[model samples]
Target chain A: MATGVTATAGTTRGRSRLRAALRVTAAVFGAYAFAWGIAAFGSALGALAGLAPAEAVTAASLLALLVLPVAALWAFAVPRAVMGWVLLGGGGALMTGVACAVRMALP
Target chain B: MSRVGGPNRGTPRKGKLISPALRAAMLWPHTWAGVTLGGLLMLVFFMGSLAVFAQEIDRWMMPATRVEAAGVPISLDHLSLDRAVRPVVERLAAGRAVRDWYVQLPEPRRPVMALRVRTDQGNAGGMATVDGTLLPPVGTLGASSFFYPLHYSLHLRAGFVGYWIVSFASVAMLVGLISGVIIHARIFKDFFTFRSWGQVRRSLLDLHNLTGVLVLPFHLMITVTGIVIILPIVLPAGVQTLYGGDIDRFYTDALGGYERPRTGIPAPLAPLDPMVAEARRLWGGGEPAVIFVHNAGDAASYVRINRDTGDRISLDVEPVYFDGVTGALLQHRRPGPMVATHRVLSGLHFAAFEHWPLRWLYFLFGLSGCVLIGTGMLHWMEKRRVAHGVRPGVGWRTVAAATCGTTTGLLIATLAMMLANRLLPAAVPSRELVEVAVFFLSWIGAGLHAGVRTVGNPPWSGQCTAVAGLAAACVLLNWITTGEHPVRALAGGDWAILGVDGVLALTALASWRVARRLAHRPMRMVAPTNAEVSDHA
Candidate 1:
């Protein structure tokens, strides 16, 4: 009876640890995606403007697209990815904020 | 008593593997999380899938309008801005209380110059020839305009409820997808394997998993983009904190300056033809889709040109402001780095710039997502039958009915609504309301039929019949109402309408085949197994 109780207790502890690890991974991935999206948008803009280093800007945009799925998959495995996810989400929020600001400031 | 004669005599059973308390905790989260949000997710996927062909549907439904591209080069030479400005202003001010006015020039597919004026009471717009004679108000509810908006915003009471519902569904979908992947670690190995003739449960599981795995990338992209699409609404608290709670101000800065109305006194204006010609010089001869005139009949009046080329998503032509009287080019508003990025993202999400080929691909992907959601629901019901240790009860039955009704019934309802469009009187009061009523009524009728008639029978055959019937009706109705058979329409170069009918006929044929197969199948009565359990879970 004592052994059975100990075994159940050990399983519960292991699950709790796994849950914590996943949460942390999600945060890190969210942050990475957020930064990547902003950078990608900037590069795309540079490509449009016919500015210096145009080729590099185009390359960066393509890279961002390729990496997005990988980062999302990583978020599923590690809790740290959550940070990156949150960061990307936060960036989207910022862009939206800027849009709203521009709308109001205009005549 | 002999052990052979006991109740457990012939059984080779193991003891319970999981404690009751632990099982309850684990199962509670899975059941409530899935059941609570499953219906809403189904609605989002189904509507979004339909929205993939929104533009094509628009072309099919509004067949009365005709546009012939005039390859006339826009020239500023001998143009008079005076004639165009004075009349539009006088007409707009005289007709109704104005909120905003938009003017669009002739393009390849839409040759008539269009003016959209939103009034205090409701939205009203008109298209006219170059000479300014008004055309009849176009009928037929543009599924692209109505359904696309409703897909994301649900077109509910002011779109608030719809947005909230979609946001919640997105979050739930994210959770479900994550848990589902973790549960099925061997997802890739069996990616291409599908056995249609397996045990009932295994087949169901296979369908759910196959659809989910095959369209996994599309599902993720759509879900993430959907959240990104409404980032502002979801995180308004942060914006309010940073921007002093003035939402409009924030938008103006983000989107660049709003076109401010000119304070200068009114003056005689030049003809619009000259300004259009000037715009063409800058935009390289592409037909302008929209022409925004700022400060009409004033010294500061500016005309912004938006081209309608099929390749580029963004209207990249610079806004060319002109003097109303002099027709001299004024300041141009060029797009900066950030603005261009915003436009590209918007274009991708809306599929605004896609050709027919890419649009069809989007349609297929969207339909696959819908199938994924529908099969997910079916898998849930199958899982519950095994887990509950009881015969499928009223709750399971209700979900089954709803699943059949909402997924297949929605397709049926759409066809019925299209049929109603042709048969109903054009001048009937509240035509939109009547059309909506027909749509809902048909859907409700389908649900009631499925619930009563297919309680014990396999639901797939009934659903297949319903979908096939509606699709067949759609084809027939198109022929009867339009007075053009598919072959005749195709030969006459009316491809859009004919294509719509052909697609519906093909869908009908496919559904009929599925129904026939279901009817002939011998092993249709067995309960589902664990493999299928994981498909839905």
Candidate 2:
């Protein structure tokens, strides 16, 4: 009985460690995706707001870069890493998708 | 682990972690990451600091690139662009299917007429006088070509590899900066405290903290901006998605690509003087720094005048266009507000518009960043030695040697490259390549020397002695080869050349003093091997 309990504990520990590793990996991808997606969306939004292509590109790109470090630090230090992915990664992808669609629709 | 004479300096008397356990976890990562990549950071910082003076170095390196009599700012007052450059255009047009020709109008900083011809075959170029008398090649790549790029690309093979390595180091730097702030408990206290004459370990830590904090804002800005500048290369996903892998197309769309299509029909080239005069009028007394003629000797040929941006913090690249034949004003694209903001950020990073005093301040801050990284490296080794109970392994020892070589070896390599430029035969085929070869070899040699000598304490004094010798050699080499010795330069009022030699002599003196001081300092106790333990007794 004791041996079986010990085996179960070991398995649980191993599984938890793997989950932690996966979460961290997700966080990495999320942080970068969020950073890139914001720049894309920002540029499109600027273009939509009647800015010149050059102006839009420059303004959006710089603003996005400023946000990147903050996003990176926050991703690593979040209470639950999954929440960071939901808020930043998912939101970023959605924003970029909408922006791309809007850009395509415009002249 | 007592405070007065603790065996391990890092060991706390109370041994309490800073408030939150999660925040405390950041400390270890910060220290280890900085240690692991500190050498690369040191190289970046050290090379970058020198690159601030790249233009001055260029002037020193090419002693023959004369502009005018001393104290007189050279201008293209007497020269007409069409009359003076007709022969150059005619000669170049004789070649097969030329695409573009770049004619750099003389500026006060670099008062020489330079032209580069881009043909269907490839690019070919030479320096020239206002009358198109071809000047001989300098045979040395100036700091603009070498150290400035080395600061960013590390002279690695041309590919994504160099970009990746630099970007990775930059990321490491970011982490180091962030974590360093947290781990440095009592940050304000560290800002005020520098225990230089105290225990060696304490002094090392204090110096590291002091320099790191002194230039914290600069360090942060340089790192963040560096990553952003190389963003497309590092993070290509956004660009790839938007432009379908066409970088040029993306730039065209974003930068308002103003390229005129080539008309194959040939025609006589028009005079550039009128166009330049018109451009100056448009710029309101500012001269055009560079003039570009697209589709040279063709009906479609157009002149683009890039405005001088020395006074403005922004690098104003928006050129005013003119019809080459009619000299009619074509297109002038004014930058928008966002574009203006982008210019400010990039301008701040490059500091091209900054004057001498600001440039000197940037140089000092950059050097402090180098010192900060160097101290961090030493502290890491010291910390490791105190924590571990055995002699440092081969890997650790190799790093120690590299730490010595990179700091001093880099200086020697740079000086050697310059010396080789003066000493090497200028007529030798690919003379530029030969000089570069000498530079790499000297750098590698320094790394090897450090690897061997840094067995216990790093041989700081010995490397400083080498530095002093090499620096002295630099001054001597310039005097022997250029015939414009520091003394002669001073007599002639050629401060540019004299400044380089003066700085070299001062550096040599500084190194000698450092060697003397380092030689007398007590060596730190390494994890005692049999030899070290016996020596200790």
Highest DockQ model number = 2
TM-score of chain A of 2: 0.76
Candidate 2 lDDT, B170-256, residue by residue in tens: 766776777677657677887898888876666888888888787899989878777766665566544544555566775655544
Best by TM-score: 2
Candidate 1 lDDT at B490 equals 68
Candidate 2 runs further than 4 Å off:
A1-30, A79-95, A101-107, B1-23, B66-70, B85-97, B130-132, B155-161, B230-245, B253-256, B526-537
Error of 1 at B33 (Å): 5.9
Residue B507 of model 2, lDDT score? 88
Tens-place lDDT per residue, model 1, B1-537, is 011011212232357333232222222233444566676677777677668666456655654444322334432232223455335534645665544456765443444556766555565666665555566655556676566766788776473677877765775565556545544556786677788887555677688778778877777766766755554454343234334545566454444334556665767556667677777787667555566655655655555556664567553444566565687776555555644554555556566563778767777887777777676677677666664434567877788777777777777777778777767776888776787788889988877877886554437787788789888887787677666678886677655666678888998999999899888877435454545433432
Error of 1 at B294 (Å): 5.5
Q: After superposition, how far is residue B310 of candidate 1 from its true place, in Å?
A: 2.9
lDDT of 2 by residue, A59-102 (tens): 66676666665565555445555676787788778867876787
